[model samples]
Target: MSPALRRHAPLVLVALLVLYPLLPFLDWAVTAIFGVRLQLDRQIINVMIFAILALALNLQVGYAGLLQLGIAAFFAIGAYTTGILTVDKYPFQLGFAGALLCAPVVAGLFGLLLGAPTIRLRGDYLAIVTLGFGEMTRVVILNLENITDGPRGLNPIPEPVLPDWLRDGLDRFLPADRIDLAAIHWIVLAALVGLLILMKNLERSRAGRALVALREDELVSGCMGIDPARTKLTAFAGGAAIAGLAGALYATNLRTTAEPNTYDFSYSIMVLCCLIIGGLGSLRGVVLGALVLLSFDNLVSPLLTRALQEQLGHDSTSVFANFANWRWLIFGGALILMMRFRPGGLWPARKREVDPATKADA
Candidate 1:
């Protein structure tokens, strides 16, 4: 990369992401020539939503070295919280915005609950505890038939609405039909951008250093006057809060709370895999990982399967019809390759340099 391009790479990326939702409106000649309309707004939104979740996981695993195996539990908490508070089936009806605001706080509280008692555990023990909590959360949601609708899921979970003035202003520039999708895309993208900034700031803060120190050597950091318990709890709760935020936005886009199984253990594993693929602890890496993984799952797999079925003149039951089902195999192969070669990550954290004088003193 040229020095100038490298210097402004992040800005260029953000600009591209910001302009992506408007691609369909650009009237590009190639689209008409190919007869292939690129309706990728939903895919972009989904990718960003997962990016938020992956970044949350990054905070716990990358920043603080906390092995969280049950992040989907918190995700479920956020989605269900939004559903219960906003859906007309119940009396809460706090509205979409209110529910969105509250979901993260509620998930964070649950984070504190789980972390308070288990903060003393380390490594594998902590991982086991988290995995159990995740499954337990899914089971609890499953059994709560009345509140969550159990296996049926919650529907008509209303979409967010902008104020009349804002809607009117937007209508002047965008088609009424496309406004809602575009608005949702903008909202989620803005949230992702905001969180990215917040996380960047956090990584430079005193607490960030403490988390890193604790991650390096807990006992040694404690000797330096860091409170390991507090730091771990903070990372845990903070990560949960971000996951909750992602869940709320996800539900809004899907227009449902989805089934309890939606937040299953595999969901957590998927986010973990995102971190692993992107290189843990790098913010840009999280976004890239999410984009790659989610785009393949939501876009490429479905499109490829459809194209193959059409070309082969095959029905859904035909042998060549289910390309999407191979996602796990592909992911597993990719992970094995990543571990074998780029074990540090696709974008590993830059190592800190110690001054020669300080190294000599040590």
Candidate 2:
């Protein structure tokens, strides 16, 4: 790459992401080349949502070195908060904007509630606690039929309202049938971009440094006057809030809260896998990992499986026709290979540089 191109690679990537939904012609091009229609808007939106989740998980697992196994609980909290506030069944009827504003706060509070007592736990014990918490949250939600509508989930959630000028501009590029989807795509994309900026800033903040110090050596961090409990709690709550935001976006996009079962251990593991595959402790790795993993799961697998099924005369019994079913096996092998070979990750975190003046003084 040219020097300028390399320097501005992030900006270029952002521009490409922003322009992706607007380029309807890519759908035609992809169809012509691949013989399968791509739901670019929906696919990208889903990827962005999971990307947000992975970023949130990265804040805990990657940044603070916390083993969080219950991120999905916070996710469920955010989605349900949005659903309860916006759904007509409840009187709040805060609409889409209200849900967006409130979901994170509610989720963050829950994060604090969970973290306050358990922040002292470490390693496998902490992971086990979080695992139990995740399962407990789902079970509680499942039993709350009166409040949550149980397995049926909440529905008819409010759709987002876009301003006329913005809508008009988008209408020019997107088909009328896809206007709403395009709007959602932009919303999720904006969230992803905003979160990335926030995370980048957080990494440079004093608190971020404290988290790193704590992650590296809790005893040393304590000797250096950093409160380990406070730092860990900050990471825990912040991660939960972000996950909540992701869940809200997911619910809005799907027009339902879905079921409590949706927020299970597997979801948390998937986000963790994204972080592991991408390179923990690196923001770029989080985004790249999310893109690679989510795109494969949402787009490539389904499309490839469908194509194979078609070729096999839609034979339900043929294993070749069910390529999508092998996702876990493929991911498992990928993880084993990654750990065996490139354990640092696809874009491993760079070591911090000591200041030249500090080094010289030392």
Candidate 3:
């Protein structure tokens, strides 16, 4: 292939891969042969959402070297912000657009609050504080009965309102069980693509360099004129904002309750595991991480359950049917293996040379 073709091949492949599940033919073929139906539409939606969280997480964990074990705190903040705004639990209803606008801001503010005092600490200390923040956020949500309904959580969180014609075109015309409001998924995928571009740019920008410097050696970077605390805090806020945006989208897409249980410590650990298994400092790795975990959780595991049922008939236990429940155990093993064998991750980040032209411009 020509150099230009080589350059575009990955893009072409990714485009096909993203669109494949949306097409029915592949699903039909797989079901016909494997006797397991794949919920590709829901899987794709989830992959895109978690991919955003994983990417956001990379900012703090990979680039900034902050051990944030409480990312779900910000995620909860974002989700609850959207939930309270749009639901009837509050006197005011902000709707989907408002949720999108407000969720990230609230999450980022919380991030700022959490970072202001905690960024100075490092290693296990920082991790512990962040973990506390995560649990604390959940507790606060559980206690705030007036606005959040406490343990009941917020239900029927509204989805994005799109053009009526578009909705008709998708739901009315597409094959049954294909996907409703598929335009929503397309919009989200577009947003993810845009965010991915911005993140890639950020990785190449001066702020990215400052973050990397701090990650490498805080004391050395501080002596050379970098403000360690400020840089770390900035990264924390940015990551939180991204998580908040994702949280808003998540609540919207779920169209269900954004309960406190949903944003627990395990969720934070899961995203962290995704980042680690995918490869630190590798953008592609974040995508890979989401794909691996979500695909197993949503796609393969369910298929395994169906296959088990067919093999053993109705008497088969729910345990075999819901192997996805064991995802944490699977994730734990994957983390241990990754750390021991491929510490960099399944798709390790490659070091890029500094562009002199960009450096001089800086």
Candidate 4:
């Protein structure tokens, strides 16, 4: 392939992949070709949503070398922010767009506040602190009964206000069935594309270079005139903002209570795993990571459990029947295997390289 084709190939492939779900008879094709009812509609939407969270995480651990364990706190903050603003019991009733607009900003503000104090810490210290923040956020939400309805969480979060035409377009090919997420799915796909473009550009921007430099050596980066402190702060806040957006979307889609327990430390770790397994610092890696890991947990686990039960003699008390219950054990094993055999990831991000031709042009 030409250099240009090599460069653009990933983008082209992603575009096609994103569009495949919308095609007529795509579901039929999957069932016919693989004899597997691959219900991709919701699954693809889920992956795209989590992909945003994974991409957010890439900014910290992947690019800036910061160990963050509080990503879910920001996610919770975003979800709760929407809940407080949009739920009918609340006075604001900001609606979906308002919540969407404010979710990331609120999360970013929290990130800013979080980083201002802890940005100086590194490695495990930082991780512990962020982990504490995550737990604390959940605990606080659990206790805030008046504001958040405590453990029950806020409910009835509004959906996005899409145009009738867009909804109509989404229904053109599919049966007028369930929630009809076609429009929402398309919007989220657009957001993912926009985020990917933004992140790729950021990877090549001056700020991105400074972040990479800091990752390599904070002292050296500071000596070279890059403000390490500010860069770290930016990384934290920016990453949190992206995660918050994902959370807001999640809450809106569920249209149910945003339970405090749901945004616990485990959720943060799962998202972290998604980024790591996909290969840190790689946007495409995040997409793959979210799809692979989440699909395993959401889609494949059930099938595997049922198959095992049928083969091993169906018994709810039998270990085979509890296969789906081994979610974390499976994830933990996957993490270990990935770390051992493919530490860089299944689709690891390429190491940065300077092209003499491009440098000379610049």
Per-residue alpha-carbon lDDT of candidate 4 for residues 84-133, written as tens digits (9 for 90 to 100): 88999989998888988999999999999988989998678999999999
Candidate 1, TM-score vs. the true structure? Answer: 0.91
Write model 3 residue lDDT over 1-362, tens digit each, in one string. 99999899768966975575357676578667866666556667789889999888999999998988999988888888888888866766888888888998999998998899888985789999999989988898888887788887787687776578765666765753455445557666876887888988988899998999888888899899999899899999999998998888887888754678888899999999999999998988999999998888777777777777778787777674667767878899998998999989989888877799999999
Please, what are the lDDT tens digits per residue for candidate 2 over residues 98-184? 899999999999999999999899767888888899999999988999999999888878778678998898777678756777678
Residue runs of model 2 more than 4 Å from their true location after superposition: 169-174, 307-321, 355-362
Selected candidate, larger lDDT, 1 vs 2: 2
Residue 188 displacement in candidate 3 (angstroms): 1.6
Candidate 3 accuracy as lDDT: 0.83
Model 1 alpha-carbon miss at residue 7, Å: 2.8
lDDT of 4 at 74: 88
> Could you tell me the lDDT of residue 293 within candidate 2?
91
Cα displacement (Å) at residue 237, model 4: 0.5
Residue pairs with clashing backbones, model 1 = none
| Residue pairs in collision within model 4 | none
Q: Count the backbone clashes (under 3 Å) in each candidate.
A: 0, 0, 0, 0
TM per candidate: 0.91, 0.93, 0.87, 0.89
Q: Per-residue error at 53 for model 1, in Å? A: 0.4
Off by over 4 Å in 1: 26-38, 306-321
| Model 2 alpha-carbon miss at residue 90, Å | 0.7
Error of 4 at 239 (Å): 0.7
* Local lDDT at 182 for model 1: 69
Q: Tell me how many residue pairs clash in candidate 3.
A: 0
Query: What is the alpha-carbon lDDT of model 1 when measured against the actual structure?
Result: 0.86
**Candidate with maximal lDDT:** 2
TM-score winner between candidates 1 and 3: 1
Q: Tell me the whole-model lDDT of each prediction, alpha carbons only.
A: 0.86, 0.88, 0.83, 0.83
